[model samples]
Target: MEKRRLGRTDIDVTSVCLGTMTWGEQNTEDEAHTQLDYAMDRGINFIDAAEMYPVPGRAETQGRTETYIGNWIEARKNRDQYILATKVVGRSEMTWTRDSENLTRQTPAQIDEAVEKSLKRLKTDYIDLYQLHWPDRPINGFGFHSYEDYATDDMVAFEDILGALNRHVEKGNIRHIGLSNESSWATMKFLQVAETNGWPRMVSNQCVYSLVARRFDYERAEIAMREKVGLLAYSPLAMGMLTGKYDSGPTPKGSRKDLFPTFLGRYDLAKAAIGDCNETAKKLDLTPTQFALKFVESRQFVTSNIIGATTMDQLAENIDAHEIDWTEEMEKEAHRIHQSYRSPVA
Candidate 1:
């Protein structure tokens, strides 16, 4: 229940942020609302969602996640009590998000349309932190580990994207901006553009960081410390791999891995590393979930750890992970695991 400053902004958000990407796909509306109520009661003050959410990204259930949050806001009338963050889709072929195009890009006009729709769906006048879900350039995000450079002239300029977000800040539609699934070079480039053009600076970079995945620690950690754009780490549990549920037996029924096996295929290469982590947790007299969550929370560059769940028990366990006292032995064990695996899931 500790709060941290979001970048250089005046807002102080909880270190644990409730993630709602499973609202409409794996959970119902009522379940989503119950999760929200319980999270608020537990002192979580930040909620993160996206326009192209409830993942699997089908045309049928695209925006239902925001609609669920909107209904909760309408019913509770407690919009002022928490910080809200959502995202706009970057360059992709999932064109169902927009009305006019078959591809989604971070162009100025597309940003305008995306922000308006998100506001209407969230039932809010302004978003505390609006994020670009990914970069406009052609790069492998979402679990790929290859690097390929594309034609520079083929992509939208970073200045145009920041300029568009600045217009939203000026109009009171968004209070701040952030990035997701971005690289260190691009993060610095965005900051440079903002400083040179006198535009809004990015407040955070939301990415995947867990015990089994340490890609953010390589170079972005320094940027986070120096530039003040700290990390909002998602999937800190490695998409349920760190919970020890899969270590002993078959996949549990209705779990994320069971429902969408292909989505978490990135962890396949790190199966041995994950099993080692679970064993390390037991040696430390802690559950794998607690160990994994605390390691992400203990990082100096982490602004908030985004936790998601489809059931009440899972939600409670994830939130309670904040209470664990990080010990020296735990840190050393984590380092041993890292030295052995060395970002197997990255």
Candidate 2:
């Protein structure tokens, strides 16, 4: 596995990071530990989780993902071997994550509480990268049904959020800060604020980026190159659609599509475009998984390609894709697919 510099920091993370969102819900603790051990043996040293994980987030499974990782960390006692990353939720109604409030926000108190709980759940003294799951700004959310802008005065400011994170840095609770599902303006503003305050910089942006989701490439790619805050690409497989498993058959049993069909949101809109990418992969004698995963990994602006799996076989296949040599022919085909589809999901 290739390692890349994490932003402008001295630390280096594998180009392929293990994603843990499905651990507690789709998988059990033993399975999560198995995946962790296998991933480390495969030379991957970056792991990412979130507070409200196992996605269809509910109170029952809210913190189970972190607890599973925490258990693995406790048993293995290998905290120094890998970089652990997790996120604090942005503005939302996932109030179960809070102690007293009915809403989650990026306010200093909430950030402090979030970090403290995540530390306890992860069983780690320090988090390598602590990210805001998304911004607190009132804007279009995932697979938006409408766009509405609220008053600017209604949200937590960037400096305050970074300031809260800085306190964690000072307390040796987290090493770096990052953004997710963030926009260009906020990305730059955070950097500017950090520079002004001489605070820890926003080192990366974890966002939805894949063959069918190239919105990051349009503008943020340049910011990544010049500012050194590269992307932590998520959903690189288009939620497994690019794997071609769903290309021709009924939804596989025990699969995400079969269990929680709504979680595959927005991908349904780009069915034809996804088909083009997957079909093109077949024509080139490549597994659609390889083509899709490599496409995200190959991008210059990517710090790490976060891959998730519910089973060992899927884990192996995703890890194997990292070894496939990306060819010029493949790049051209990815380009052709993008031009035809124009990032329909974004």
Candidate 3:
């Protein structure tokens, strides 16, 4: 696995980051541990989790994902081997994350509480890369393409959020900070604030970027290249749509689509484009999973491609995808797919 510097930080994370969003929901603690062991053996040095994880986030299963990672860290005592990253929830109604707050925001109190709880749950003194899960502004994130015309006069200032994260950095609770599900404008704003205030800068922007979803390529790619805050791309397989599992048959049992189809609704609008991408992969004599994963990995602005799985087979295949040498032919085919679809799922 190739290593890249996270932003301008000294931490060098593997190009393939192991994502742990499905651990407590579709997988057990033992399974999560096994995945961690396998990922480490495969030279994946980066692991990403969030306080509000195990998607389709229920109040009952909210922090179980971090707890599973914490248990693995405790049992293995190998915290120094990999770069650990987790997130603080942005503005949302999933109030179960905090003790008394009904709405999650990037307030100093909420950021303090969230980081303390994540450190306790992760069983670590410091996180390598702590991330803001999303902005605390009124914007339609998480696969919604159209901008919601709404007032954001009451949104928390970016300076305040960065100030809170700065305190954590100063205290050694977090080594660096990043962003997720953010826009180009927001990224610039955060960068400006951090630079002007001499605070910690964002190291990466973790967002959805797959063969079917190219929203990051439009404006953020340039920002990533110039600013050094490269992309830690999540959902590189478009929530499993780019894997060809649903191309010609019914949704497989125990799959994400079968368990919670609504979460992957963005892919529904790109069905034709996804099928075409799968066919293009076959035409190139490659599996759709390999094709999709490699395309994301090959991008110049991608610092790491976050891959997640619920089963051992899926985990093995996703990790093995790093071995595929992305050729000119594959790039041409991917370009053709992009020209046709033009970010259908964005």
Candidate 4:
């Protein structure tokens, strides 16, 4: 596994990161710990989670993912072995995450509350990397091709958000700060504000980046290379579209598509392109999983490719994809797919 520097920080995370969004929802506590153990044995040292995880978030299963991870940390008693990363819900209706607040905004009090709660759940004094799950702004970040108008004035100030996170850093609640599902302009703005205040910089941008989803390549990729806020590519498999599991026919039983099809509605926007990508993978003599995962790992701006799984076999295959050599022919095929599709999902 290749190690890359996380932003300008001293941390060097593996090119492959273990994602835990499906841990509590699709899998059990033992399964989450099993995946964590296998990932560490495979030389992967980065773990990504969120406050609103087990995807399809609800009040019942909220924060269960972190609780499971905290259990693993307690059992292993080796918190220093790997770097743990988690996020706070940003500007949403996940009010259950807070003590008494109705809305989950990135305000100072909310951030403070979120940090303390995450620390308590994660069973750690300090988080290695803390991220805002999404921007506090009122924009449709969930893949609206053309920007729909939103009230820009009705949002928390960037300075306030950064200041809140900086306070957590100062208090030893988190080591670094990051962003997710953010726009190019917002990323630059946060970086600039952090520089001005001499606060902790945004180390990485966790966004959708796969063979079928390449919106990050348009502008944020440059920000990643130049500013060091590199891309922590999530959904790098297009939610299993790139793996060819949904290529032929009906959704596999008990799979993500079978369990929660609406969660994959974003990929439905680029169905034809996704099909072509899977076809391209076969033409290159690579499994679609290897093709998709390696493509994201090959990007210059990608700090780490976040891979998730519900079973050991899928987890092993995802990690094995990192070992394959990304060839020029593969890159050319990926480019051809991009030219035809042109990021329809975004």
Best-first order by lDDT: 1, 2, 3, 4
Q: Which stretches of candidate 2 lie over 4 Å from their true place?
A: 144-147
Best by lDDT: 1
TM-score of each: 0.99, 0.98, 0.98, 0.98
Compose the digit string of candidate 4's lDDT tens values, residues 1-346. 7999999999999999999999888999999999999999999999999988889899899899999999899899999988899999888888888779878889989988888888888998999999999989988888768887778788999999999999889988899999999999999899889889899999999998888788888999999999999999999888888889988877799999999988898887788998898888888898999899999999999999999998899999999988999999999998998898888776
Give a tens-digit lDDT track for model 3, residues 1-346.
8999899988899999999999899999999999999999999999999999889789999999999999899999988899999999999999999999978999999999999999999998999999999889978787776777767687898888999999999999999999999999999999999999999999899998999889899999999999998999999888898888888677899999999988888787898999998888899888999999999999999999999999999999998888989999999888988898799986
Q: Global lDDT for candidate 4?
A: 0.91
Point out where model 3 deviates above 4 Å.
none
The per-model lDDT (C-alpha) reads: 0.95, 0.93, 0.92, 0.91
What's every prediction's RMSD, in angstroms?
Answer: 0.7, 1.1, 0.9, 0.9
Instruction: Report the Cα lDDT for candidate 3.
Output: 0.92
Displacement of residue 264 (Cα, Å) in model 4 is 1.1
In angstroms, the error of model 4 at 129 is 0.5
Q: Largest TM-score belongs to which candidate?
A: 1
- Candidate 1, residues 1-346, lDDT tens digits: the string is 9999999999999999999999999999999999999999999999999999999889999999999999999999999999999999999998999998978999999999999999999999999999999988888887768788889897899999999999999999999999999999999999999999999999999999999999999999999999999999999999999999988778899998898999889999999999999999999999999999999999999999999999999999999988999999999999999999999887
Q: lDDT of model 1 at residue 194?
A: 97
